[model samples]
Target: MIVTADLAMSLDGYIAGTGVSPDNPGGDGAEPLFEWIHNLASWRERQGMTGGEENRDSELMREWFDATGAVVMGRMMFDTGEEFWGDNPPFRTPVFVLTHRPRPTLVKEGGTTYTFVTDGIHSALEQAKAVAGGRNVDIAGGASTVRQYLAAGLVDEMQLHVVPALLGDGLRLFDGPGLGPRRLEPVRVVDTPLAAHLTYRFAT
Candidate 1:
């Protein structure tokens, strides 16, 4: 079972802009950061909605969704995306949220079930993998969570949808205590007008 992570980041390495609030979830530059996948037919289909342009971007999004069986994310993502995701979230799988505060199991309208993990990062990953069975467990992040997983060397595969934007100061995907040095083997690369999809596997 591969532990995977996927993110749409800016050219400056920021996953999200600063001043993230209830109103501006990804902050001021949030829209531009994730606009690539927002218009995909796969995104609309995941939301149980219809009518969206189908293309390579949409196909990529669909592949990611299909590949993932479980998800792990930070508390910030849950808080900020709760309202935006509405009653049904796009991830139609079990989600393990890393948080300080413990909450009751939130069962949504779709197959998605939010499980809060207060123990530790490894604990969350373990739970997610168990639920995922033999399928891949995705680390759906908000920077901090991704960093923790990466630093621990738990991620087997990663895909970054690099958008053409520069948010100098914000939450970065690699922000954390020094991860030292690491290497990645390029798996695939796809270029588009809005973003470039880069897939990599942790070097063995």
Candidate 2:
């Protein structure tokens, strides 16, 4: 199974902003960053809603959602966005969360189950992969998590949704020690008014 890190970032290269809170998970000035996907028809359907326009963006959203089997995420993404996800997160799959604190597995109303891993990144990835079976293991993020996986060269594919906005100061996507010079081969590029969807595979 291949590991993938998928995320949406601002044109300035920030996955999130500073001073993240329960009120502001993506942090300050980050709301516009996700307006693209959040407004898609597929997004609304995932939320159990109706009445949205269909377009290439929404079609791509459906493809992304259908390809994931399991997810690995950081604690910050869980704490900040868990409640906002309601009882059923859009993931609809097993999610292994890397955290310092250990917690019991949380099963939501839908197929989504969150397991907190206190051991390490490898442990979380192992658990996620095992549950994922032959399907892809997705590295769901909050910048730090994606950076960890990318730095380790564990990600097989990376799909980035580049929003048109710019965050002057916030949590950047590539900010980490020993995380650059990793080569990638562009696989696909889809352009929309809201964002540019870029897909890359790790160069073998």
Candidate 3:
């Protein structure tokens, strides 16, 4: 199965604002950073079942959703504290989260279940791959998980959502050690008023 990583970053490359506080929260509340994705038709159709996607970015977003099978996330994403994903979640596939803290196996009514992976990213990837079959395993977000996959050379594709915002600092997605040189060729580019969607395939 193919392993793909996807994330959204500011123009200055920051994922969240300077301080990881509660009031300020993630860079620009983090919601504005991903409003572009939330507005996509595929995102609504697959995630919420309502919304109009009529731009290039939405088109690419739909393509990514269609290409994905299983998804993986980090502890920070599983928390109900920092990120508020409203009453209903947007993901419909099985999602595995990496963390040392154990939690109950989440089985959402909308078809999403949060499984904790204390064993590590390797274990999570193995499980994700088995569940993904031949479609593709997707790395949802969080810098650490992506870095681990990159270092292991397990990522086959990457999609970056470059939003026009500056968070100064928060979590740098590319801050960790560089794993040699992995070539990423752009497969698709979508420009919109909100964000630019860039999809690339790993070429090493």
Candidate 4:
């Protein structure tokens, strides 16, 4: 099973704008990054909402959701998304959360269960893979989580929805030192009015 991470990023390389908190999860000026997918039929369906545009973006979203069996995400992502997700989370699979604090397993509706992993990224991935049943394991993230997996060479593929807007200062996806220099082979590119869907596989 391939380990993949997907994120909507700004033209300036920021996945999230500055001042990210539980109160303001995506942070300031981050709306442009995700505005593309918010109204997609696939996304709306997952959120239990109705009536959204059925287009290439929605189709791509459906494909990704269908391919993923389990997910691993950072604690911050979980905390910030918990309230917004309500009882029925979009992920209808097991989700292993990487966090230092130990918390009991949280079972939500729609087959989504949050299993807090205090050990580390490796431990969280291991557990996610074990339960994935050969389906792809997704690194569902908030920038930092995706960076950790990429640094460790755990991500097999990455899909970046590059939005046109730019965020001058925020959480850059490729920031920090651990990543160094690496070659990424382009798998595909689907350009749309809202964003450009870029898929890449790490070159071996």
**What TM-score does each of the candidates earn?**
0.96, 0.96, 0.85, 0.98
Candidate 1 per-residue C-alpha lDDT over 48-165 given as tens digits, one digit per residue, 9 for 90 to 100: 9898979999999999888888999999989998899988999999999999999999999789999999999999999999998688999988888888889899999999999998
Off by over 4 Å in 2: none
- Lowest lDDT 10-residue stretch of candidate 4: 29-38
Instruction: Supply the TM-score for candidate 3.
Output: 0.85
Better of 2 and 3 by lDDT: 2
Error of 4 at 40 (Å): 0.6
- Model 1 per-residue lDDT at 13: 88
Give the winner by TM-score: 4
lDDT of 3 at 160: 83
Compared with the true structure, model 4 gives a TM-score of 0.98
The residue-by-residue lDDT of candidate 3 on 98-189, one tens digit each, is 99899888777566677888998889988888877577889876677788888888888888889987666577877888677777887888
Cα misplacement distance, residue 9 of candidate 4 (Å): 0.4
Residue 40 of model 1 has an lDDT of 86
Worst 10 residues of 1 by lDDT: 29-38
Predicted candidate 4 versus true structure: per-residue lDDT over 163-189, tens digit per residue? 999899999989887997889999999
Clashing pairs in 3: 17-27, 17-169, 44-49
Off by over 4 Å in 3: 21-25, 28-32, 46-49, 80-83
